[model samples]
Target chain A: MKTEMAAIEIRNLTYKYQNAEAPVLQNLNLTIEKGEFALVSGPSGCGKTTLCRCLNGLIPHFYGGELEGEIFVDGLNVRETPPAKLASHVGLIFQNPENQLFSFNVERDVAFGLENLGVPPEEIRRRVDWSLELVGISDLKDRAPWELSGGQQQKAAIACVLAMQPSIIVFDEPTSFLDPLTARGIFDVIAKLRRKLDLTVVVVEHRLEALAAHASRLILMDHGKIILNGEPRKILAEAAERLSLKVGIPSVILLHRRLSKLGILEGLTPLTTSEMAAQLRGVLNRD
Target chain B: MIRLEDVGYVYPGGVEALRGVSLTIGERSSLAIMGRSGAGKTTLIKHLNGLLKPTSGRVTVDGVDTRKATVAKLSRKVGIVFQNPDHQLFAETVEDEVAFPLKNFGFPQDEIKARTEWVLELFNLTRYRKHSPLTLSGGEKKRVAMASIVSWKPKYLVLDEPTLGQDRENKLRLRELFEEFMEEGRTIIMVTHDVEFAAECGFDVALLVDGKVSALGSAREILSNVELLKKASLAAPQMAELFLELEGVEAQPVFTVEEAERLILSRLMSGSGRP
Candidate 1:
């Protein structure tokens, strides 16, 4: 169900926090189509988080910052709409899941957003059940949010967002605190969620190695602006220095960069280690 | 110099966060604690600095029983940098935040100032000395926390997820500081989920699972052990996993990009693994 309508569109957006000297996000313009999966990465303090706030209507509304330009979500003007009004169409999963979840139980936490939207009690119950099962946290429905592990708490937060039935979802480093195995599992769940729903996924993460292969588009930000935006491999291959942070670049891509510099390998960059190994097999297997 | 003897801890809520965990960290060594969340890594490290005493078993540093010693006395030998900076930060400025530890430890103003300034420079926070730590980004806050703890020069440094908010360059910088500490014969114990960080530092790894010491050994040998890592719900670093998948030229599960590149180049250049 690919649609031509842009799930998110920005026009010359610039924002600065109240006390901050310079704009955190400056003159950023972009468009993400419905159902598109985009991964955003950059060094710390590079405005990726600020851009996420802008996408979710938290920049000017909740952050109390000076914001300029325009932002549209699902063809609706974000500047004119309150965050409460935009919650139904755009769901933002923050960096710390524990901070976002405050309910007595996992079930109630997931249903909190639905209840806020005046969803009927019957529908709320059904959604809480459906989302908890989808996120694989149904068994922990009775447990308090504080009782779950970091990974499980993150899953619960995602369920809360999923229940809102937003067409666009923004995950702000959702798995930063998780181990590699659990982090990969969360991404797998997200991929499954994408297949099951018509959604635009924007993931802002430092662990790009785990999620690079799944991203259809990669956006690299620096100094409050997007420095590179394109296919994953191409961006990593061409403008790697700007994307120099190790956490965000895949190991395979790092190896590829080194190999290219030594003139040992060239032509295409691999986003995953397995993909790189596949590319190397041909070279290594040639007698 | 840091040792835990069959240490087991049960929180007030009746949750067994740690159990039967025994490990010894030698002086002048770097050890990485790897485990999934709630697998008892944090609980285990808290025992290092007397933040959380073991309900059973024992934890000792330098033959002194941690359970009997005061936290203030233990702070001189073992300083812990928590994952969340806000937990430890209270000063209005970053400079004062780093100084608070030294001053409370009864160091003279000159020593406190010197130590605070040195750590601020080391952590790249000198420019932000006057700024409130609360206003900094997550990465900067993490650095501030470290600077505050390391100012007193403890005998053992226990870091809880130091790389939580850091990128690759920042991690490398932090590794340099860790290396500097190692040179001074200080034991460094870090709890982290960053497998790449573990591999980069060449630390001896202690894997904690369900409050037990699941495995402890050279990170190289253990991180390459896929089955053991899988048992704890952990994955080998991407480089290690890739090396294992390759069908050529005696590849040991390499962990870092440099090691992987060396293996690939040796095979391809010598044409040894070629069909």
Candidate 2:
């Protein structure tokens, strides 16, 4: 049997929006293998969102932009396939939840994408229920979308995309509008769902502290190109050394770097606060 | 000074947003209101101006009851940059959006033009000054919304989640701007959930839980107490947590990297020499 192909592939991709002076995405190349959780981050206006839009055929089709490159999502050429056709394979969650949610109630909103794709009623119901529970928002099924808080509405948006049962999901700054606790809860939900579904996940976020530990790979974009892409720990360590990436290194990593420079602590860099604390505890008691 | 005396707000849908909350925000002070979403942080700030009057109690801004003042009249002293830029941005161009507030506040043509240019440049929006506000990205629109309000130079600046969607560079810029604004003896009342930002700014924090002011103290006191933060459904800053989790490391309240460094250095001298 042939091994499963990469979940997403892009080669020398460059896209320019309508009436734009320069290309937002310039000669970008990325490949996300199956079931890989990748986190993409960069400074504001670094073409992160534009790259996400390209994953599901929104570049040349919906936005009417100049596109030159090849993109394959689950072996289907994104340039050839329309967004509607790619919906089942690749789900895109917008940065703002308000942009995606339109239905009156949460349950109906979760069911919207499935119903549009002509999925059977019973199947839609099953998938909607599964997704709502997966995102830990089953209690919000009856509430109106407008009544839910920013965090809840974002959960609902995730459920809407999850209900489609896509093999890959791209979340664009899903927690930008949320509080720290709520943002952590959102990341937890994403990790849980990715593990449960074995889906490839790509999250574009600024809260690297919360996401760096969960991501299998981290990709940093700047001025419309991927400047760094590799293991999250390695990339984050490198980015911390450079300091100019300004990708918002987690506080723990910065602390680790400071101690290492002082010749106080050494070894693997800690990604989370707890990890750093654990390492410090070992060294402090080593006397 | 802004004062809320047992303020209670019941929404039109009969949802009680705020309940018997009493607080005072003095002039030239920086106050950060933090709570989980839907905990009435926004509702409490809405009472600062006359945007939402308390249903059961009174709110006074600088000795004048909000109930007795019109929103337009109160707006001269208090300007709010709402959380969602889409709600406040209505002008065609970015420059016009920043100028609209100054114009509405009755600034002269030359003053409005000068102030608008100043804020636009301060926010680094000169390149997009002619572009429509709607055409900008989320972070850019947020800056425009903020620039529009700050252009008026209100005595009290109210920011709702000012750091949301901002990257590191912009967040640093905002911290600098807030420092400059507070140095001029103006007050800033910000409702945010960014613990790191709050700790960095050294703002006095008020923890709101279910529309009630549960705790009020300095950012050092409030943010370092993991128990208090947990009660409000928030986590203490990681720096604080690191010190807490490490055993036998008695230190003062640590929230930022610099403080943590100092504490660790003192401990390192006692425990072991530097490698």
What lDDT is obtained when candidate 2 is compared to the true structure? 0.86
- Clash count (model 2, backbone only): 0
Q: Report the lDDT of model 2 for residue B4.
A: 94
Determine which window of 10 residues in candidate 1 chain A has minimal summed lDDT.
A239-248
Candidate 2 residue-wise lDDT, B160-193, digit = tens: 9888767888888888888888899999999988
lDDT of 1 by residue, B176-232 (tens): 888998998988999898888898899999888888988989988888888789877
Candidate 1 versus truth, CA RMSD in Å, comes to 2.7
Candidate 2 lDDT over A1-287, as tens digits, reads 22357899899999888766778899989999999999998887788888888998888898886999898888888888878888999999877788888888999999988889899999988999998998778988988887776667888898899899899999988886676777888789889878988999999988798899999999999989999999999999999888543688888888899999988888788988889987887777676
TM-score of chain B in each prediction? 0.95, 0.95
Best-matching candidate per lDDT:
2
Model 2 TM-score on a 0 to 1 scale: 0.94
lDDT of 2 at B46: 86
Provide the lDDT at B55 for model 2: 96
